[model samples]
Target: MKVLLTYTSMTGRNEKIANYLADYLKEKGADVDLEEIIDTDAFGLTDYDAVIVESYTYHDGEVPDEAQDFYEDLADVDLERTKFAVLGSSSKKHIHFGRAVDYFTMQLNSSNGEQVSDSVKIDQDPDEDDFKRVRDLGDRVLKSLK
Candidate 1:
């Protein structure tokens, strides 16, 4: 499976989790690509069978700036053939926790992208359980391909 992991991180928490998820997927024998949302291009997105969007929630339910363009570019894709999952990293203490994931999932669905299932949300101080959810998200995405 060709998978793309695109992420935007401000405090490095999201970056670390994105990398961890990428490594886990790679270990499972899936072809994975990791791109910082800011560096991603439209062409790169077409190459992946699945795209996992990772983002941090900012004030008032906003997605970070670095990923806004990446999210916007998603509208241009012919998403009928793609499978995707949204992984959100946020602090539960934040008022808008997991809101970015919700928005991205909605946007992707509106653009005709197939959602594997619900989103996976990791909290500020994620433990092993949080990591398991990430793995589960990957598993569900792969499952959809079959």
Candidate 2:
């Protein structure tokens, strides 16, 4: 399957998660294209069979500035044929932890993207348990293609 994994990270936590997911998906025999949200421009959802968007929430559950354009682009597109999942990282102390994932879920649903699994939210840095959840997430996405 053709998969695109994109993320925006300030402390690199999200980047690490994205990389792990990419590698795991590749190992599962997927053709994965990984990129940072800032480095991408005018991408279409139809280009890939599935997409995974990972992001860190900014103040009050807002999308980070670096990933705003990519978020907006996804919101603006028709994702009828795209299956996607969202991964969010945030501090558990925050009242809106994982709000970015919720936001992306709404946007993806609005744009007609098929949600392959429930969104994954990581509190702070990932640990062994978090890695297992991420791996399960990747497995779910890959399994959806069949």
Candidate 3:
């Protein structure tokens, strides 16, 4: 399967998670395209069979500035046949932890994408348990495709 994994990270935590997930998916025999969400204009969701977006929650659970354009562009895109999953990182101190994942889930649904798995949220860096959860998420996405 072709899988696109994109992320926006401020302190590199989300990027690490994205890379880990990419490796996990690749081990499961998927063709993975891992990217940093710096240029949303060049991203085309239709080209991939499945997509996973990883982001770190900005202030007050908002999308990072770098990814905002991509978030907005989702409304104009057609994702009828693509499956999506969202992963987000945030500080546990925040009241709205992992809000970016929720926002992205809404956008994915509005864009007609099939959400294959529940969203994953991690604090700062991922631990062993977090990695396991991420792996299970990949498995779920793969299973959904079949």
TM-score of each: 0.93, 0.95, 0.95
Choose 1 or 3, whichever is better by TM-score.
3
- Tell me the lDDT of candidate 2: 0.88
Q: Tens-digit lDDT track for model 3 on 1-146?
A: 99889999999888888888999999999999998887544248988889998888889879989998899989998897589899977889998899988999999888999999999999878999999989989999999877
Task: Give lDDT tens digits, candidate 1, residues 19-49.
Answer: 9989998998889999898998854665778
**After superposition, which runs of candidate 2 have C-alpha atoms over 4 Å from their true positions?**
none
TM-score head-to-head 1 vs 2, winner: 2
- Worst lDDT run of 10 residues, candidate 1, spans 40-49
Which residue runs of candidate 1 sit more than 4 Å off their true CA positions?
none
Error of 2 at 130 (Å): 0.6
How should the candidates be ordered by lDDT, best one leading? 3, 2, 1
State the TM-score for model 2. 0.95
Superposing all C-alpha atoms, what RMSD in Å does each candidate have to the true structure? 1.4, 1.1, 1.2
Writing each residue's lDDT as its tens digit, candidate 2 over 4-91 gives: 8988999989989998999999999999999987876535767889888888999988988988887788767898758999997899
Q: lDDT of each model, Cα atoms only?
A: 0.84, 0.88, 0.88
